[model samples]
Target: FAKFANVNDATSHWPTGEEVFTHLPGTHAHAPLIYVALMTFILIISSVTMVLAVEAGHRMDKKAVIKWMAWTVVGGLIFLGSQVWEWSTFIAGYDGDISTWADNGTLSHSPYGGQWVMGVDAHGHEVKQMVTYGPTLYANFFFFITGFHGFHVFTGVLFNFLVLRNVIRGVYHKRGHYEMVEKVGLYWHFVDLVWVFVFTFFYLV
Candidate 1:
């Protein structure tokens, strides 16, 4: 992972073992995996609530439909909030070594960016190791991909809210079919499915 050079490097054109930095920074205390799991759980619950809303619509139970749809909206909002927090943490990086650097007045930056380390070489001799915080492209990709998905979630929540309002207004009830609920439910489910892929690739992998 650390053997590859940056994509924009103008010097090296191949894996010459000269570049030992990764393209993505390592995880730190700020970005916990449990938070991601919680987000996933909330999204899954929201999807289930959407299903319940659709089912209630099928039975023409206006109150139940409204209730489930409201819960779904709440879940989506919570997930969006969580994503915002995650993005903030990622952007802020880790502060473990910041204080020390500040005290020295040399550099006051997160060590997650890059640093040197003392490690024993193959022959048990101490050596200075060069480490890097990873490529800027990783952050760009993280923001772009997750931000795109977050936009979808936001739109889904907005649509769900509108559908909920229509339900309360008896718009679907008058139509004698809850097809709108089902349609929005499909969109919500698709958003949830896309999140699963995003979570797996971005967080898990």
Candidate 2:
């Protein structure tokens, strides 16, 4: 394995790679596969339900459209809830988890108050061993990017609920347009798209 004294020396973080670097360290973290898998399924199913909603709208099946949208909204909300729980768990972790919540790192690896410990995995090492100071700047970056994604998920939950409320009131059905579903579908798909990058960066590469 090669080591870079500074992040700029790393190829993955380099400007030429900046296109993929858009998400940065977030794509590198040890993601929870179960969460990622479940989220993927939810997003795929949501898309399918959305398609059905549009078809039902075309057929003028107001009740059927409402039912499908309701399900989509439910899936989105559930995903959001799971994200919140994940964040909470990450923030509250102590033992092996990086305690970046305070930026003080007192909970895990705050060697110099603001400075966190950085560690490299030794031969045969399986866990993320920390340095006296944190897992280098990469871990910090990983947390920040994933935190942003989780925040997006959190906000998406609210948006999903709003659309669900409108659907329940038969707003889209009355308007004879399912653009609301389309809009939400766009956003949901975007989230899924982002996750695909996250999974590859964090879990695979």
Candidate 3:
């Protein structure tokens, strides 16, 4: 009888996590899932394209390798430009309605300045109404990780360009090896690995 009563008390009108979060201010939910998804898919597909390029290089199909590398460069540029646009949207907020929130025990908030991030401050409590703030820890991690990956892509394009240059000049043929493509493929794979984690942590969930 006692256990039954306690269980009933605990279950009666209990708010779900969403219900609790519904009252929070900074949960403004300003994400363009479409754009983000496109960018993610593009990067993933480009990784596959790069692998195909590397395989072509391995098989001594210089023409096929060059074609794929050219495509990879274009795809990489597209992804980078998309990210720049995404960042601009985030920074400006949507339709000039930048969200902002402050914790005054009551969760009423405003959207005058962009809600770039929601995170805890020095005392391990959220700085709810961050009107003008740079990268927080989460942003820091995302920037460092993703920015590093972008850097790698940029470098990869440069490396691929050089490889193409050498290939066109019959350098690889003279050397009788495709080690350059093989080595760069390893770096490309690392970029893909980092992106998988970023997509999971940042976008998916």
Q: Evaluated with TM-score, which candidate comes out highest?
A: 1
In model 2, what are the clashing residue pairs, if there are any?
A: 27-201, 27-202, 28-202, 116-133, 116-134, 117-133, 117-134, 118-131, 118-134, 119-131
Q: Which sections of candidate 2 miss by over 4 Å? A: 1-32, 94-129, 132-136
TM-score versus the correct structure, for each prediction: 0.70, 0.60, 0.65
lDDT of 1 by residue, 1-205 (tens): 1211233243221211112111123443333456677789999999999999999988999999999999999999999998887676555544533211111122223556544333233121111011122343444556777899999999999999999999999999999999999999999999999999877755554
User: Per-residue CA lDDT of candidate 2, range 89-195, in tens?
Assistant: 44433233343222212224332344344334322221222231123455455566677776776666677678768877888878978677667767866876786
lDDT score, candidate 3, position 162: 83
lDDT for 188 in candidate 2 is 68
* lDDT tens digits by residue: candidate 3, 1-205: 2332353245322212121122212344533355566777887787888888888877888888878877777777888887676555444444433333344221212245532344343122333323222353333443565677778778877876787677777788678777887787777777767777766645544
User: Cα lDDT of all candidates, in order?
Assistant: 0.68, 0.55, 0.58
The all-Cα superposition gives candidate 2 an RMSD in Å to the true structure of 9.5
Off by over 4 Å in 3: 1-31, 96-138
Report the C-alpha displacement of residue 2, candidate 2, in angstroms: 18
TM-score of 1: 0.70
Considering summed lDDT, which 10 consecutive residues are worst modelled in model 1? 14-23
Q: What TM-score does model 3 achieve against the real structure?
A: 0.65
Q: Worst lDDT window (10 residues) for model 2? A: 15-24
